[model samples]
Target chain A: MNKPPTIVIIDYGCGNLFSIQRALTELDVPSTISRNPDEIAKADKIILPGVGAFGKGMENIRRFGLLEVLGAFVASGRPVLGICLGMQLLMRASHEFGYHEGLHWIPGQVTKLRPGQPGEETVKIPHVGWSPVNFNSNNDGLFHRLQNGTYMYFLHSYFVTTENPMCGIATTTYGNNVFCSACCKENIVGVQFHPEISGPSGLRLLQNFVFLK
Target chain B: MKNRRIIARLDIKGPNLVKGIQFDGNRALGLSEDFAYLYYQEGADEMIFYDTVASLYRRNNLIEFVTAVSKHIFVPLTVSGGIRNVEDVQKILRAGADKVAINTAAIANTSLIKISAEAFGSQCVLAGIEAKRKENGDYEAWVDYGREPTGVNVVEWAQRVVDFGAGEILLTSIDREGTGNGYDLELTARVAQSVPVPVIASGGAGRKSHVLDVIHEGRADAVAVASMFHYYYAKPLQRMYSSTNADGLRLGAQIDEGNLEFLNARYGGILERRFDPISVKGLKSFLAGSGIQCRNM
Candidate 1:
């Protein structure tokens, strides 16, 4: 029998590391929280949990010299999960608290959610609470066992718009057909919602991630 | 076009619900169980439980309280205080809280708003902004339970929090908190205009007219009152019931007498026949015995 993979949650002065750790722990998956580049580099899987402004969060990663380390880890073909702001940091850049660069692991930019058509009621930023995620990819390992139109909890203002549509494994609806959620290239999955907070369905999603190839 | 929200704030201190003025004139009111049950029966859109001691002790017991309260009510429950990370947010949500409010942590990190909002969903993340009118004629954001000044402009911070993915902004005026002079209309209007998320006005609600003023003039999506409701110092029910005359008429219809009678009988008459102010301390003690933590403000 093979041993379960070790998961490492990044702790770079972002929000809520313990909650994710607790979720992983509940699944009997061994995990550790670390801000050190060395620890992240050696992990079997890396989970990036973030909260706050995108630019500042990215700056913290750069300041701690975790960018190169993260880039190398992704290059190594191990699974990397970016949650919320962590997902946003995976984009090329964001216009939060001023134009700032992201890690650029995924090819995209983070932009605010706005009303799609003219004269449409502003769809309001920070699309909070529980909303459904429409899974677009059946073969995507990140969401392999998840069903389409599954409801997950979401809380985000900015979303990623990729030049490569194939990178988006799922999408959710807000005011119009704009991107409410997404996942990326295999081994690099970014979810706009917090599965850890989405009740039973979210817990199952995290379980799938822990056991994914 | 969003509906207005009527929120009741429960401040827990040890095993009692306390109310005070200027965030200091503290006093025990009633058991949390009775108060929460009563408010839910009265059609409160939401409930906010602030663990005033969590930060001081560096641990959150509000989750347990929320879980206990959830068993008795069907409305959304928001728990706050001492929520420092995503794990804390997740635990609170799992424990039955519909939303987690982040205050001091947000001022210290700001990014927590985005991270929590992203991980949990924006609707589950609430950014609490404590503001005070400074001598400089501008509102400033305060942290450390409204003890320290961030020196950040209230309007700018509100917009930034929205950008950071905060689903709602809970704005409390420190100056007007216990004064019941009415909401800080100018401050609230400034924030509501600057950000696109729903803004909840807090502090200084002395009458039902104040709730109306905050909703109309302040342009707030909701109003959170503590002292007025907790101490029975004002007629919250009358105000809630009277709002039916408003043009928008967002308040929920009054519960029918038949339904009230059924509830009264079902709950063994613990529920009062009318909506009146109750003791915060008494309510907290009742809930504490039932495994809920009530923090008095």
Candidate 2:
């Protein structure tokens, strides 16, 4: 059989590295977790998974000299998936813990979800829990096999607002705030929810990412 | 409205999944990982594994199970118990746990919450509050598996932890825990109302209505169930595993741990008269039927 496509899970010392790897393993796909730019350069697909503040995430990405390599990887037209904070890192800039510039892989700003108005059903921050994501008309296969309004687990305080409305592939509502939960531009895709732990729907989403050509 | 969460809380004693009434006399139901996977499959929004004995032992023994369980189930996992410092939090999160719930050390120092939040992020830190109602009708915070009192008012402590950078609160009612009586809604509402972040009401969930009541009345953003969910499967799983002699099907079925002695009197280690088992899926549908939003299967 042809060798399975090489999938690289970028390790910037910022997120849970094993959960996604284990999910891929369950899918019968072998992947590598590396921060080395050389290994990242040779991958068929690359996943940027992060779980922290945007400033700190960018600091680590630059410290490891991954900015140029990641930019080039995106430029190569290979499929790229960014999960949670990793998705926020793909935007032009983030206002989390002071303004920090991102890879600009997609033009967007990562901003905190506005607090719900008083006496109007308070909207919790960190948006913790399982919320439904409504898919747009975009035909990106990342959400293939997943229905609109399918509940996915989300645990982030900030969300991405893309400059181009078409970039938003899926949107989730937490209180009155309906922000872009998933975005795509060219070969790059980003999701605010952690699909690795999102049950069957989540597993299916990852399977869809892997099946993408 | 945002969907409220239904979390499956697995209380671990040694390597076994245990449940106790009023925070004492725990009986082992089965292996921890088995039940965690079962809950995940049943549509649990999240999972929290609390090491019941970790505080006394001064070390969390849940790393192995966290690593094993996280590999199979694709949901956010929270680990609590004996997480005294930032390093402990880092170790648990690195082992694939998405969040860490702290109680004993946070009460002792309070800075652990702020420091861990800064070191990691606010979303990574959860303040575990064990509250017991006093005679004056006020709730006080307890730690070390509800064995010691901190003389701190529960509602005040909830806000304090949030101010200290805790992203969420895991509020357990020691008075209602494992009692099948239901949650302490008054206490849950007091703390939940005071905090801006999400409050997960835990410890007592005897039936479907009790789960509904906590969300509606107590204002809890999430509800964590242990006995109501676990007991539903304990007797059936015991009979199936024992009949097939599938000891290996479980992680460590033969281990003499937890309140196995209490379970020895019964045939399958469960007291059928005490509480009825409710499936996580059943509770979700019931909640949805009652107009409360939950993640649909």
Best by DockQ: 2
Report the Cα lDDT for residue A65, model 1.
85
In terms of lDDT, the poorest run of 10 residues in model 2 chain A is: A137-146
Each prediction's whole-model lDDT (CA): 0.71, 0.86
- Model 1, range A27-102, lDDT digits (tens) per residue? 6778999988888889999899876678778888888888889999999999888998998888889987789988
**Candidate 1 total steric clashes:** 41
TM-score of chain B of 1: 0.77
lDDT of 1 by residue, B68-92 (tens): 7665454557887889988898889
The single-chain TM-score for chain B of candidate 2 is 0.93
After TM-score superposition, what is the CA distance of residue B179 in candidate 1 from its true location, in Å? 20
Residue B263 displacement in candidate 1 (angstroms) = 13
Q: Which candidate is the best by lDDT?
A: 2
**If you score just chain A, what TM-score does every candidate get?**
0.93, 0.97
